[model samples]
Target: MPTGPKHQRFVFVEHNEEGQACGYEEDCRCMIGEDHDADASDESLNVNDAADIWLSKGMDEDYMFGFSEAQLRRAAGLS
Candidate 1:
């Protein structure tokens, strides 16, 4: 079983008053909840073979949730 402190994958999009997407965010955190481990690594996210948060807030979700043909097929269980 995985033994590292638990982390939750996240994705959020902020909307403005005009109903347009204004910000996007994604990351892995050591469960920022009522309970947490002090030793948990804040840099739990890995990108490009390195421990890092792939994208910070303020970007659009499209880049992270792109609809490539391969991804679509995988999502539809066609692969």
Candidate 2:
């Protein structure tokens, strides 16, 4: 798992203009060059079982891709 504040936060997105999230760094680079709106959050975190649950609920369904809590848990193999 990532250590410290710098590595703790992570960005998760379902898709960008190109479709399904490829990577954050590349997306940020392309978008920044175009001067398009880009967002970041201190809320992103390195994955752990509990964090996975929180992430599912936190994803923005209307503005971004997000998985339901149950879906995240199942994907994490949590029974």
Candidate 3:
């Protein structure tokens, strides 16, 4: 069967001390949720990479959730 839209699989981005997106979350939550891994690497996210990921997931640029480009950049540590 064909999977629905990619946006339906929205992955949560874990933030670090500086409020930067570090890595992806498999089940919404981090260490407390299922599929949690304490040894997971906290890689920093880039603004361009984040934007591409959102676009690839079928999210409309103009109608994106409450998050703005600035926010994405800041959260990705690109700012």
lDDT of each: 0.36, 0.40, 0.50
Q: Summing lDDT over every window of 10 consecutive residues in candidate 2, give the lowest-scoring window.
A: 1-10
| Model 1 TM-score (2 dp) | 0.19
lDDT of 3 by residue, 1-79 (tens): 4433222123555444454545443424232434344456677454455656666666567533435666555644557
Model 3 pairs whose backbones collide = none
Note each model's CA RMSD in angstroms.
13.3, 12.8, 10.9
**Candidate 1 residue-wise lDDT at 62:** 42
**TM-score list, all predictions:** 0.19, 0.23, 0.28
- How many angstroms is residue 24 displaced in model 2 relative to the true structure, after the best TM-score fit? 12
Model 2 scores a C-alpha lDDT of 0.40
lDDT at position 51, candidate 3: 58
TM-score of predicted structure 2: 0.23
Model 3 scores worst on lDDT over the 10 consecutive residues at 1-10
Per-residue lDDT of candidate 2, residues 1-79 (tens digit) = 3322222223544333222343353323331344332464646423343335465667434422254444444445664
Best by lDDT: 3
* Higher-TM-score candidate of 1 and 3: 3
Clash number for each model: 0, 0, 0
